[model samples]
Target: MSSPVPPQHARPKRAMAVVWASAAFVAVSAAVIIVHLAGAPSGAVEPSSYAASNAAPGAPQTVAVGPSSSPAAKPSATSPSAAVTKTAAAPPQEPPKAGWIPVDQAAWQAQVAAFKARKIDPVPAGVGNLPEFRADCQYSHRLADDPIVFPDMPGASHMHSFVGNKAVDAHTKAGDLTKFTATTCKPVVDHSAYWVPTLYDAASGKPVETTGFRVYYRSVRNNSTGIMPIPTGLRMIAGDAKKKVPTPRGAQGQFYCAFYGPGDLDGIARSTNGNWPICGGDATLHFMLQFPDCWDGKHLDSPNHKDHVAYGSDKGCPADHPVRIPALTFDIQYGVKGTTQGYYLSSDTTGRSASSMHGDAFLMWDSDAMNKRTKDCIAQRRTCDNNGYLH
Candidate 1:
């Protein structure tokens, strides 16, 4: 009845609408439940069903978890320990000592003391012939009437002739032999001896006495040809000699004051110019001392030698004797040997041919003679020239 209705079709449509509405409602509820579960904070209890499925009792819980508010914190694994540990600093090292010490220091002092205790026997004094020959004696090319130019001796002959002729003429004119005696020979001046005390430690500031002392000399000849020949001598004198005599390793002192040369002859000539006109040429008779330990021309194993004086055209001989002229140069050496406290004096000339024509003498002296001569010179303020005798 009810309008006989649209029949069963309209009723079925209404029933379908109601079923769709119910399905939609169920879907909306499911979505709401999922969002709530996702939004919940950590450590917060979930609904009963979710808590039972995903969480366990006594576990770490989070509440209201959100985006991190600050940077992640570091763990405590790398933290410093409660107890403190410290290390001490190392000490500095010392510098090394120098090798050379002052002569007054320990090692040098001991050496000097030992040297003083060792007694040296006295040596005999006598005239001795030099076993070697002489050379470097001749007239310079520039000099007139080159006196050294003998047929056999090329260099030394002129020097010999000059000296011999002057000596003979001087004696003849003076009419007295006493003035020309060996003792009358003049001493050389302007000579020096360097003393380098051997120190125990050469580098130290302390002073140490030397174990012994040494005597050194240099003989040089210059020619117009621009050639210069220098020879050197070294002598070791032990400190054990008499207290009056220089001790080998004792304090610094100079034994020989004068270094004789041809120039002295010039002074003598000037003094006696009225007597001998050619006396100036005789100055070559002056000789220098050479020690035994010196370097011989024939020997190569000798110590190295050097000269502080230089060679030049203007560098004239100390006596104003002609430097251009060749000279029969002689050097002397004095020292102690073995256990002898006395001096060992030796002479060396230029070469054999030169010395043979112009002979040279070598002499040894006892302490008495040495002291007497040295004292005599000191008293007179004159230089001691002669070692012993003239060859």
Candidate 2:
């Protein structure tokens, strides 16, 4: 009887069936929040898989994307990556380079034993073993054709940097650099090839290689003249484009502003007006060109590669350019940073005034390593560096 009294319309039909099941669970939770706000983005999580792709001719119904948890990501051979790691190439150590760090290792071996104890004391025209040898080449790149001032324009000239010929320029013709045979130079007997003038900041055209090259094949008179081997379609022209001559110092087109490490750490050496200084904080920028050890023995190139070459005076090669080989000194080095408001010479292509700016050399070597570094380092006067050993 008591139970029957509880049926007050069955409690209003069970409260109208709990208000229609709470309005059908708020309409299925607002349709699952509108399908998760119309399918993700910024809540990011779209990886369930979809196929049928290959469009880019009219690209449309696509489905190809994956790879970017980012770890040097590189996926996409039509997608197949696990966050790239690859790794392998690394075994050519020798330099603080590759973003540069250099500065220790006993101060770069005491700036290379004070550049091998520099000494040219009264050795300027006797013509043999004067500086004997030194061909260090390292820095490289820069161009502006100069087969003696654009011998058929191969870029015209003014931004030099050619170390040991990667096939130099200006319409190259030391017979197109005699059959290549790979070289960057280092006792392969003197692979010949060197260049300069290119240390930028010139209001930021940005350029600054050359931090190694000290090809100083000497003979400033002793045996007066005993070296040979440049003759192979030889062509020349050294410094004086207008004259920002990096380190030339006389007896023939000289200039200087020196200094390169070991008085403390990065021994500051700069006065460069055109040798274009900007060193340490990240050092770089150097030059010291010098050529012309007379040589009119018989032309191999001369349309003005300095008219058959001449400039060994102090009483020597003037007997009508008689002959006295080996005389080149080009010590360049530039990694550059900061300071700069001066520098020129891509052979001053007509803008001259880094003192007339100049530099052009083309002597295609490798001819058995330039006749075995002219019969073993300047005819045995020895002291190699251009790779003929003995250094």
Candidate 3:
């Protein structure tokens, strides 16, 4: 080396060039390895078998690579994200349908025809059971067509009574007649204070006597058609002193008068035994205009009348006394099986009032007849009888 003591400048320049070349080679090798591990670009590097060199103490560090670095090492459809997508895309199911049908018209007409074949009868002349009155009775197509026609009746002028007894004019004077008569009348022959009589007295105007007339009646209507039967009842009351009478209670009064008829049948007087007016005094007679049957068997012993009326001579009459009668009508129709529900007569299209009156004064069917009708109705599907007691 001493013998070759060439120029100092040339020696230093050679050493510098070598150092620069070494640094470039190290940087290039590092870039090649990094590119290979990252899935080398198409023209970046060639596949080769070589071991990586050790980095210098102060050289930059890098992450190590393994066989898992291959591009095909991706997740499959069984992944969590895929499962969530499938679940979100699914839809819910629906429920099944139900079937129903409407009632037929021909069936209803047939029922009406059958009812016409089995007609109703008029009320009897004396006190007795309702079923027995059917022997001598006439049938009418409709309530309006009934032969019994009321005169001087409150709602008769307004055509209210024609519909039923609901539309009676409450503001008129005749209207009061119906109200006073319907009240204070007892429907049953009970020995209670519910039955009050009428008499003229010297003081306190006209006082109602404890013992009087006992009347019972029943009426019915079809809510769907507005058709109904005549109202009817039987009357039993104390007689006057002008004739000899019998009293079970041994009271001073006698039992002379007794009469029964339809709503239009008026001026019914007792002429056989003595001069006894069938319906007289300051009282006006009325039947159980309309009533509903107890389907639940709850009201087996209930009265047929809706309420009682007080007929006073002061309103516009010859007598100066107070009397009681039965008023109010109702419309009743078949309901659900085992149900006692029904409609009221006041709700009919005819309208209702205190003075309103009903047509066709025939007697109501007794318990036996009602039971038979109910059974037949159930068989025809016109009504429901759950207990089978109607049969």
Per-prediction TM-score: 0.15, 0.25, 0.17
lDDT of 3 by residue, 1-391 (tens): 1111111111122112111111111122223323332441111122122211101112221211111112232222122111111111111131122122222335434443454555333222321211101010111001111111222222222111111121112121222223322111111111111111112111222211212111221111111122212111211111111222221111122111112122111223432322112333322222211222112111111122211111111122112212111211211101111101111122121111111112222122232333333323322212211111111
Report model 3's TM-score to 2 decimal places: 0.17
Top-TM-score candidate index? 2
Candidate 3, lDDT over the whole model = 0.19
Q: Judging by lDDT against the true structure, name the best candidate.
A: 2
- Candidate 1 accuracy as TM-score: 0.15
Q: How well does model 2 score by local distance difference test?
A: 0.40
What RMSD, rounded to one decimal, does every model reach? 57.3, 36.0, 53.5
Compose the digit string of candidate 1's lDDT tens values, residues 1-391: 0111110101112111111111111112222222332343111111111100001112222211111112131112123112122111111142122122112235323433443344333223331211111211111011011111111112111111111111121012111111222211122111111221111111221112211111111122111232112221111211111122221221121121111122221122211112111112211111122222111222211121111111222244333222221112222111111111111110101111101111211111222433333223221222112332212
CA lDDT of each prediction against the hidden true structure: 0.18, 0.40, 0.19
- Badly placed stretches (over 4 Å) of model 3 are 1-204, 207-391
Error of 1 at 331 (Å): 5.2
Preferred candidate (TM-score higher): 1 or 3: 3
